[model samples]
Target: MSASPRARRMTGAQAGAVTARILSAAVGGYALAYAATAFLSVYLPMERPDRVSFASLASFFVWVATILYVFAARSAWRATWVPLALSLLLGLAAFLPGGYGVRP
Candidate 1:
């Protein structure tokens, strides 16, 4: 026999977890992509066009990896905090004075 509707439906916590995972995938993934591209473009020792192209490709991979990591994490807290921390670190590295492009 088929289960009742209530039995098949997700509980409140399950729904919240799903929502958190989706938001993490969207926002966290974008943050990771942007930070990675910015850092790579500045740090890589390549011509401008080549560096940009490489950074763009690398950002795509970073974004995908972020999404996968968010879903695979055991808890939503880790999924959110880890990427947030990494993005902040990368942002600091890219924007700090004498960090990337500053010349003596």
Candidate 2:
């Protein structure tokens, strides 16, 4: 069966939005996961090995959640910026001088 032209077609802006969403889901998700893992590993009160292992495991969930958020967002720009902002915040917290594991 043939679908209507309008139903079957994507405009250029729609394509671009989809592409942006996919890129954000893949790249932004990974970056967010990395930042979350780092932050968790540094801040979790558990022993070093336990914290590392738990953080690594939790990162998988974080990545999956980020991907979902990117797709569910109202716009591609929102998808991109929210994850980027979160990644930066987490990365900063993980690496900042006053954060745990930082030396004097």
Candidate 3:
């Protein structure tokens, strides 16, 4: 069955929201993966190989969760911003001076 006319025609605002949601999911997934891996690498009291293995496994779930959360949020705007804010915060926490891998 074909889609209804209403379903086929998307407004500019609706299109923009869809695009935002997609971009948010992609970027949020990447950011979440990176941040989670970095965090596990630094904080997990395990050997380097073990830490890397654990981080890699955890990052997959992080990416999946980010995508689900972004799509499930009531407001697309919030869906975009919340993950971005979390990405920024976690990224900064993982990489800042005196953080995980700093050599100072």
Superposed model 3: Cα runs more than 4 Å off? 1-8, 97-104
Q: Rank the candidates by lDDT, best first.
A: 2, 1, 3
Q: Considering every candidate listed, which one attains the maximal TM-score?
A: 2
- Please list all clashing residue pairs in model 3, or write none if there are none: none
Q: Kindly list the per-residue Cα lDDT of model 1 for residues 30-86, writing each as its tens digit.
A: 998999998887788999888889999999899999999999999988888888889
Better of 1 and 3 by TM-score: 1
Q: Total clashing residue pairs per candidate?
A: 0, 0, 0
Please give each candidate's TM-score: 0.85, 0.88, 0.81
lDDT of 2 by residue, 1-104 (tens): 98876786779999999999999999999999999999998889899999999999999999999999999999999999999999999999888856555622
Could you tell me how far off, in angstroms, the CA of residue 97 lies in candidate 3 after the best superposition? Answer: 4.3
Give the C-alpha miss distance for residue 31 in model 2, angstroms: 0.2
Tens-digit lDDT string for candidate 3 (1-104): 99876776879998998898999999877887888888777667888889889998999999999999988988889989888788787777767846455622
Off by over 4 Å in 2: 1-6, 98-104
Error of 3 at 57 (Å): 1.3
Measure candidate 3: CA RMSD.
3.1
TM-score (C-alpha, index-matched) for candidate 2: 0.88
The candidate, 1 or 3, that scores higher on lDDT is 1
